[model samples]
Target: MKKLVYSILPVDGYYTFSQRFLELLKSAVSETFDLSAVIAPLESVFLRFETAYKRERKSEYTAKLAAADEARDRAYLALRHYLVACSYASVEGYKAAADTLLSILKRLGWSMQLASYQTESSRLGNLIAELGQEENAALLTTVQGTAWLERLMTAADAFEAIFQQKLTAEAADTNTSAYRLRKVLQEQIEMSLSWLEVQQKFNPSDKLTTLIGQVDELIAHTMTTARANATRKSAEEEALEEE
Candidate 1:
């Protein structure tokens, strides 16, 4: 019979950093658990608080309290569901919940941008921690943590619309073709960088950055080749005319 021994050793003085990093991840998981276990069951208490506050008012208190209580309950339910949705085991489940929450917020005329920002921030934080783990890295590589990425891409598409609008306005303001072209190119480059930054924040992988650099080099090379071909064609045409 052979005896097996399992040993754990610290790697490169990163033991403390690794432990703290894992703690941060565990803390986020703990928050989800706390919210589901503790905060979720307090919806009734929130409604009761709303009712009590409404009672302090003297004018049409009954209807007012009823409306207030209803709104409070709705908000409470939304928050609970949002948390539950975020804790879902799959990205599809999470997105379904997020979509419902977004619809509710939109109907209430709330700021969609704020909701998107918070959702992206939380998802990105958790995703970064998850990707740090060896087992989860492959599982989550293609999974989107939130709808914020889609929102960002949609916004990027809108940049084209904005550029067109600005170009039209600029045309009306001045007829400088050179200025318009330069402005459009500058704006397009800025928008592209902005989109790239958003993608990098969500998944900060060196491989992705390297891929982008490679693509850029390929584009530059293609442009150089095209320019050379054009110059050669012009020289050939001039020689033919001389002959």
Candidate 2:
């Protein structure tokens, strides 16, 4: 598959946040992986897996560690993309994306914990529980400002579809589209979530139910786009290597 690259510009006041996030990702990666030796492998994986990525028959932690690195890279790339899209996002959409992204960072294991909130938007906790997700997995509260965030969360579900499945180093296969679309969703969700966070800080009046509805729409759009662009590029390359 083609490598995933997100461009988020035109978003005022978000550059610093995006840059800091990238720096944090870099630091976290450096602390975890041997860059010199692993950078190429990591890059290769990124180029191949962009979105339709899957874990090997490896241990969970090993898979999670590698996935974490890729997830971080994907998130960084997405922030840049959101900055660009920020200029056009509707008031509600912008807020939704911002909240979703912030919560996503925490959900992806990037942040250790969610801080308590004290504001009109603080009712977020209630909305999140409405989804009936797993414990501690509720990355953000379910408040009014979470509409964008909810949509972004749906995008994350698409991403998980890709990361958990495996691809072959062989000719095109039936699962290729499924894998790639998942990756695309992964990238899109990460960026959208961050955007939502920024939006919430500025406009806490957005409703949680509204954001959840928006998220469903966004997820559907993302899935369609990713599937249309499916090329089975990675599978072909893997097939060549096996020869």
Candidate 3:
């Protein structure tokens, strides 16, 4: 158990550390029924921690937003590429419709490809509006581009919805705050560990001892990395000050 020293564990590393510890506990469930009982409450706490992490971590939030943006971007690109391909079709009416749409696209005076995230949705909205006009709509119907345009509009709206729902910085002040959840997780882990330690002292199982050792190693490695990072950051700050 080695006191499960976690004070030195960095904030960012907390999720991985607790997750490793939880997995270690789960692995030992077949070894002892008592450990499983202790893990039940602890697992609930960790689930909350994970949910909080999605809200708290900027990287996680950005990854979701980026995914939405990418889908919309792909839809836009597919629409353009489809129109370009249609321009060379053998069907005379389809070729004319495609050429007219492509010409309008060029006359619009921009590539409209890989736009900045900030302006992309509105640009997509403008393109959608232009093509959705009565005249362009008729052209799109001939080439069956109406469906692709709808997909682009759907993707654009999806991205805008996600972008507009940006997370506020006050997450830490909320009930679902990762910081608060982490504190609860820490307490739950310590309590669970203490219960297990008492069990081992009374019953003395070899399986429990091995699991404890593995948990100790995981914690020790995490603490070591945290300390090294702290030292490196301090050194960098000192160098900047000297400069």
Top-TM-score structure, candidate number: 3
RMSD, every candidate, angstroms: 31.4, 22.3, 18.6
Model 3 lDDT-worst window of ten:
109-118
Report how far off residue 5 is in candidate 3 (Å): 4.5
Model 1 TM: 0.21
How far residue 91's Cα lies from its native spot in candidate 2, in Å, is 70
TM-score of each: 0.21, 0.19, 0.51
Candidate 3, residues 1-243: lDDT per residue as tens digits?
665445545446778887888888887777335576677898899888888776666555567777897677667667777898788888768898998888776765344533346555556777788999999999999998899999988998888777656535434345476655777888998888788788789977888788878877887788777778656644553444345
Cα TM-score of candidate 2:
0.19
lDDT of each residue in 166-218, candidate 1, tens digit only: 45654574333322233333333334345445655886656536544543554
RMSD of 1: 31.4
Candidates 2 and 3 compared: the better one by TM-score is 3
Model 2 regions more than 4 Å off: 1-170, 173-175, 208-243
* Cα misplacement distance, residue 101 of candidate 2 (Å): 41
Alpha carbon deviation, residue 233, candidate 2 (Å):
34
How many angstroms is residue 68 displaced in model 3 relative to the true structure, after the best TM-score fit?
29
lDDT at 47, model 3 = 86
Clashes within 3 Å, all models in order: 0, 37, 0
